[model samples]
Target chain A: MNNRDPENSPVIRLSDICFSYPGGPEVLDHLHLNVYPGERIGILAPNGSGKTTLFHIIMGLLFPQAGTIEIFGEPVRTEKDFRDVRKNIGLLFQDADDQLFSPTVLEDVAFGPLNMGKAKQEALAISRQTLSFLGLSGFEDRITFKLSGGEKKLVSLATVLAMSPRVLLLDEPLTGLDQDTQGKLVSILSEIDLTYMMISHDIDFLEATAEKIYTMKDGKIMVDEGLYIHRHKHAHMLGNMPHRHE
Target chain B: MLDEPFASGNSVIHRLDPRFRVMAAIVYSFVVAIVYRFPALGLALGASLTMIGLAGLAPGRVFYRLLLVNGFVALFWVILPLTAGGEIVYQLGPLDIQKRGIVLAAQITLKSNAILMALIALTATMSFATLGHAMNQLKFPEKLVYLLLLTYRYIFVIEQEYKKILRAIKIRGFSPGTSLHCYKTYAYVIGMLFVRASARAERVYQAMRCRGFAGKFYSLAEFDSSRRNYVFTALMTLTAAGILYLEYLPK
Candidate 1:
C-alpha cells in the first residue's frame, strides 16, 4: 500500500511486463506493479486471466514477452539467476502434485535441502522441523502420494518454508482446502514477514489477507488505496484493501 | 488373500529384521531354482505362503489389488502347460492334457508364489524406504533398486492416466469390436499417454530444478540397520536357507 515513499520500500519494483503462452492470446497484458516486502499481495483475476502467468514471470519460470523483473536490487537475468532468488522466495503451486513428487513426506520437504547439497541427516532434520511447524509431526514417515489433498498442500508449503525464503508465491493454494486449513493459512500468511504474492478471485481473500493488491487488465496494472471492484478485465483487483494494522 | 498363515505373532519371527527375511527368501528361492525338484519346491512354496498368512499383511478386501497385479503372469502359467509338448496325462474331449504341462504349471505357480509371499510376509507393511535401506545394506545394485523404486512411484500415475483414457473411450461409446477407427483411437490414447508422461517429467524436472535437484536421488534412512543387526539377520537367513536346502534338491 506504500506507493509514494521509496525510502521505506517493502520490496523492489516491476516495470511494464507482457507475457503470453505459445499460440495463446496475451494472457498478462503490459503489467506494472510494485509489491513491498511484508505485504500479502493478492492478484485477483478470472480463470484464464493470466494470474499464474504473471507469477511465473516473477519467478522467472516464464519469460515475459516484454518487461523487467527486479528482485531487491539485482535484475533476474536467466534461469540461473532465479536459482539464488528461489532460495529467497518460495512458489507454492495450486496442485500439490506439481511440487510433492517424492515418495514420502520427509523426502518431499527435504527436497529443498537436498538441492542445496545439505547432508542427508541435516536435510531430514530441517524437514522434520518444518513438518512440525506445519503441524505435520507424525506424518514424516507417511507416503506423500497417499496423503489427502489438504495434507499434500501443507507438505508442499513445508518444503518451501523449510528453506526460509524471503518471498512466497502461491497460486490458488486454498483451492481444495477446507475452512479450517484456509483459516490456518490466513494466520500463517499474516505472521510471516516474507513478501507474499497470491492469485485468487476470492474478494474476501484480499480483504482478510493481503496488505496490498494489484489489478492486471489489458496488460496493465492499476493501484488503489482500496481494492477496486472492476468487471471485464484479466487482472481486476490490485492495490490495497483498506490496509490492516499488523 | 484371506488368510495370513505366514504372519507369525510378535515373537521372534515377527520381530526378525526384514533384511533377514528378504535375504533368507532370496537365498532359499535361488537354491530351489537350482535344485528343480517337485516335492521340495512344493513344500517350500507351502511354507512361504503359510508365513505370509501368519504375518497378516493380506489386504482382505473384495478386490485383491495385489493379486490383480500378478494376473497376467498367472494366466501365462495356466496356459503354458497346455501349450507344451509332453507326455499326455489325459484327454479333455480331443484336446490332450500333458503330465509335464500340469507339473510345470504347478512349478510356475509354486515358485512365484513362494518368492512373492516370502517377500510380502517380510516387507509388505514395512516402509518402502526401509526396504530400500535393507537392499542397500545387502549391497544390491543401486541402478536396479531405483528402477523398481521409481516404477513403484510412477505406476499409479500410469494407471490413472490409462483410466482417464478408458473413461474417454467409454464416453465416446467405444465398442468391443476392434475396428480401424477404434484401433486408431487406442493408438492415439497410447500416444497421448506417452506425451503427457513426458511433459509431466519435464515439469517435475523443472520443479526439481527450482529446488536445486542435480540429477541425483537421496534416500534418507532412519532405521538403525547396522552390522550388529545383520549378525542377527545372518542366523535367520541361515535357517531359511536350511529349509530350502532340505526341501528342494536334485536327486
Candidate 2:
C-alpha cells in the first residue's frame, strides 16, 4: 500500500503556485506539492507562514494568482470546477467555533450529508453513526456553544467525518485541545484510513500520526525528515531533563 | 458565557411539542394584550402564573426576570400619574396625580407581565435550536429561521472575541475613565472587534461551503406528535375563551 510509488499519479498536485493578497506582498511564491492517495502528510510552519492559505487554495476558497491546480488528476480553475473538489475533501478549520455553525451537535454533523442531498432520515443516521464512532453517541441534542473545549473539538471533527470525504485538510487540529483529548484524536486519526494533509506546530503529534513531515518556509515546502528528534533523556542547564527537542 | 438557563427541565410544559407551544404563546400573548378589563387581565395573569408553575422553572430566576421587566414598568408608574391628563386623585405640593393615569399604568403592568411570563413558560422551555426548527415547521420564512439560528450560533463567539480584546488591553494596565483617551480607546476596541468578526465570518462561510452547504439549511429536528400536543391545544383554547368571556361579562 505504498502510495508514494512514482508510477501512481498524485491525488492532488499544485505546480508553480503563486498568490498574494491585494496590495500586499506575495504569501505563496512558486509553491509546489503533491499528495498521493492514502498518504498522511504533515506540514510544519511558523505563524503567518501561509499554511492556512495553502489549504484554502486547495479547496478553491482562495484562488492563486498563478498556478496549475489539479485534484484527482483534473485541472481546477473556477468555482464550478471546485464543487466536486469540495465535496470530496473534508477540511477541519483551526477554530472549531467557525466550523460548527449549527445550534446542536446532530444538526452540525448532519449538515454535510444533507447538503449532498441525503434524505432526512439517512442524514440523521450518518450523523449519529459518525458521532458514535468518535465516542460521542449521547451528545446528539447538546447545544454546540455549551460544549466544553474538548467536546467542541471532537464534535467539529465528527461534522467533517460525516461527509465521508476522500481527502482531509486539517489546519492546526490540536492547537488548543487538552492532553486527554489530544490522545483521543491521535488514536482516532490513526484508525481512520484516508489521505490527509495536516498542518500543525506540534512535532510530537505530527510524529505520532503522520508518515512524512515537511516544513514550510518562504512560501515553499522543504522536506525535513531529519528534524524528527528521537525521544531520549538529555541534560539541561539545571539538571538531567527528559524533554524532547523542539 | 450566555447559556440557556431554563431549557433543561422535565416538566409538562417542557415536554410539550415546541411547535404547538410557539403557536400557543403567540395566541395567548395576543389575547392578553387586547384585554383591558380587570377581570380578564386578572385571569390572564393567573393563567400565566399557572403555566409558570407547570413549567417548573426556578422561582428565583423567574422573579429575577420579572424584576428586570418591572424596573422599566416602575418608570411608567411614576410618570403617568403626574403627566397623563385625568381626574385629580392626589396633590403633593406642586404636583397632581390622576386616577386615569394610575389605571392605565396598572393595565400596562398586568398586560406586560402576563405576556412575558406566558412567553417564558411556553417557548423558553425549549432550547433555541428546537424553537428555530419549530419556526421552520410552522412555515416561518426560511431566511428568517436561518438568521435566528446563525445569530444564536455566532453570538457566543463574538462575545468571546470581545472578552479577549478587553483582556489584551487590561493586561497593559488600562482602566476605564471619562477622559477623551478612554473614549478613543473604546472606539478602537469596537472597530477591531468588527474587523475580526468579519474575518471570522468569511472563514465560517468558506468552511460551510467546504461542507457542501447550499442555500437550504436542512433541519434534523423533528416535532413529536403525541397526546400531549392535543391536550395543550385544548387547554390553551379553553383559557383563551374563558378570558374572552370575562372581558365582555359586564356588557
Top DockQ prediction, candidate number: 2
> Which stretches of candidate 2 lie above 4 Å from their native place?
A1-7, A223-246, B248-250
Clashing pairs in 2: none
Best by TM-score: 2
Residues B1-251, candidate 1, lDDT per residue (tens digit)? 12233333463445656666667667766765654466667666766666655565444631263475468567865676578878887788968877787777777666766666666666654555556756866778877776676556666667778889889899878875669987898889899999978876666666666676666666665454556457656654664566566654445
Error of 2 at B43 (Å): 1.9
TM-score, per-candidate, Cα-based? 0.77, 0.92
Mind giving the per-residue lDDT tens digits that candidate 2 earns over B40-105?
Answer: 999999999999999999989999989999999999999999988889989989999999889999
For candidate 2, the docking band is high
By TM-score, how accurate is candidate 2? 0.92
Q: What is the DockQ of candidate 1?
A: 0.41
- What C-alpha RMSD does candidate 1 show over the true interface residues after superposing them? 1.9
- Model 1 in CAPRI terms: which quality? acceptable
